[model samples]
Target: MENRWFAYLIPPFIVTLLLVAGSQFVFIQNSFYQDLGLGRTGTDLTLVNYIKFFTDSFYLKTFWITIKVSAIAALLTLFLGFPIAYVVARMKSRLAMFLLAGIVVSTFVTIVIKVFGLIIIFSADGVINKTLLNLGLIERAYSIIGTQEGVVIGLMHFTIGFSVLLLYSVVVTVPPSLEYAAQIHGASRLRVYQRVIIPLCAPGFVVGGLMIFNMCMGAFTSAALLGGGRVLTLPVLVQRTVMMEVKYSTAASIAFVLLVSVILINLFSLIAIRRLRSARLVVA
Candidate 1:
């Protein structure tokens, strides 16, 4: 059975493997892995760029910042999405359809559009500033633009939708009888919702959180636009290296690191999901 499954996976896997091979061809050829346009002159096999990535305070700081921002974004998505999922899951009307439509629309919207929209709203002379100034909130508008706040708000544009969809799907699988039993057993509404519901939905939350964290960790568009280019995420840094600077080998190395990190996160999440399932079965 496992062999049959492997056979089914082979075709697409082979094609993707070939593509990855092509991508690495240049890196392997150019011992030092510089830009394509730059012809190798003399020295090769140097790992200077990677050492710089590690030793340089600038790059290290940006790496830490990316981790911090992505973590916060994932947590915010969790807290903000839980209620919407519960409400929409329980609802049986056109209003639920409308909320689902909003989630669907949010997923379909382009990141660039959301970033530009936020830019206009939070710009120095934009609506937020104008409204605040008019209301005498302050002599100057508080700068939300080009900061972590801007990045978080922009990240939430997509992540909130992801959270809602994932959580909603998980909630649908939960047996309604459990909630009824809890209520009949004298549990309060809040207790039934929290104690009974949340524990059961842990797997979906783990999956969704890891996915959101991974996406935000490598985010380029939102971080660049909202952080005003000051927020240097791994993807944007990789882009700058590949596109602007033309450092292929170093970029390849960091890209490898990012891919490995994602694989490990997913692997750990799978283990956690399995453990939760096992524990639930034992309890049953």
Candidate 2:
């Protein structure tokens, strides 16, 4: 069975690799060419587009902003998700199980609908702003839409359900014996989680964080709908450049940069996690 497993996996893996590599090859070719207007591009190989992406401050700023926003969203999702995941994982109550089911259902809703719903909720005249105004939290309707804060908030909403689900699965895998042992050794409930559960669930946290970060990095709808041109992310910029300006080369350039950034960041995070895990093992 073990020997046959590779044979089963190899064919699909090759096919997937070919499809992904083929599309990326096209992007690489497109990135080298110069846009000649009207969805046309020159075949002449040049580094002009790549140079422009690095040299221009606006493009650089957008790249950094996208990274920053993604990081913020990832962190916020983790912060808000872990507690719910822990609760769901450890819960014996029917109500808690029902709530977990609701959270799982939330992830299945179409992201387009979710983005539109978020837009309505974050709009200046939305229920939240109206409520805040009525409560004297502010003088008038505070606009969350068309801002980075709005984009991050929407991303948190988008990611938290998935994060919770992932973390819940991870937490469930951890044997209750370890936690019970910690408690038997005079550790308080908080201490058990802090010293045992959290450390044991480190891999889940990393997986959830990376998933959320990657989603936010390439996310278009939230930035487009909530950003309202005020928070231009790399994906939104790529869309505008291709559709509005017909700059295929530039758009490809932006996309290629984003791809590289995501890959490098993922690599860095994986390496850091491995190092941390190794150090933790050494300490133990």
Candidate 3:
């Protein structure tokens, strides 16, 4: 019966492999072909697209900006989410349940709506600037729109709830007795958390950070909306290349580069996490 159940999974697995891997294979092939203007592409394979990506300064800058923004956003989300998750996971109150529900509900909202909401909040005369003005923080209205800062802020908003939820489950699983024992040894609150909780929560950090970084790397809606044509993430550039410039071959190359970069980064993160886990086990 178990063998039969495994056999039942084979058909879906093969279909998924074909649909996902097959499309990526096509994209990789398209990237090798030369772009002949007017929606035409040459049949012969060439390294022109890949060479342009490496040699051109504009493409290089966009790639750097994407990586920088994603890294910063993921790190910030991890820091901000940890405390919220830690608090909520420990509390048995109705308020804790309410907050968890709110986080879960926020995740269900459409990305378009969320991006639109961010635009309104960050506009020239928006609440942030208005509040700052009232508090005498600035002489004029400040708008983060059309800047990398705005884009990062928007990306963080999208990822924070997810980070919180991911970390919450991990935090709850930590044995309370372990924490109590540390305190009984006369360790201060900060010391106990630093020495005990943080190390154990490393897995959650890796998982949550990977998800946020990956999401930010390929994000298009926030880049298009908050970037205001000023920010140039790979995803935004890919869309413009395909839709406006009609450069399918070039776009495919950019996408393939993005895919490879994300995969490589995640692999590195996994390796580092494994090493850290091993070191921690040895110390314990």
Model 1: residues with Cα > 4 Å off, grouped in runs = 1-16, 24-47, 268-284
Model 3 Cα lDDT, one tens digit per residue, 167-252 = 99989989888899999999899988988898788777788889999999988988788888899999999999999999889999
- Candidate numbers, best TM-score first, in rank order: 3, 2, 1
Reference-based lDDT, residue 232, model 2: 93
- Compose the digit string of candidate 1's lDDT tens values, residues 192-212: 867878778876777789889
Which scores greater on lDDT, model 2 or model 3?
3
| TM-score for predicted model 2 compared with the true structure | 0.89
Q: State the weakest 10-residue window (summed lDDT) of model 1.
A: 33-42
In model 1, what is the error at residue 189, expressed in angstroms? 2.6
True lDDT of residue 271, candidate 3: 84
What does candidate 2's lDDT look like per residue over 34-131, in tens digits?
87877789878998899999999999999999999999999999989998888788887788779888987888787789988877875678988889
Model 3 TM-score, all chains together:
0.93
Model 2 spans with C-alpha error above 4 angstroms: 1-20, 281-284
| Candidate 1: residue 213 Cα off by (Å) | 0.7
What TM-score against the true fold does each predicted structure earn?
Answer: 0.81, 0.89, 0.93
Backbone clash numbers for all candidates listed? 0, 0, 0
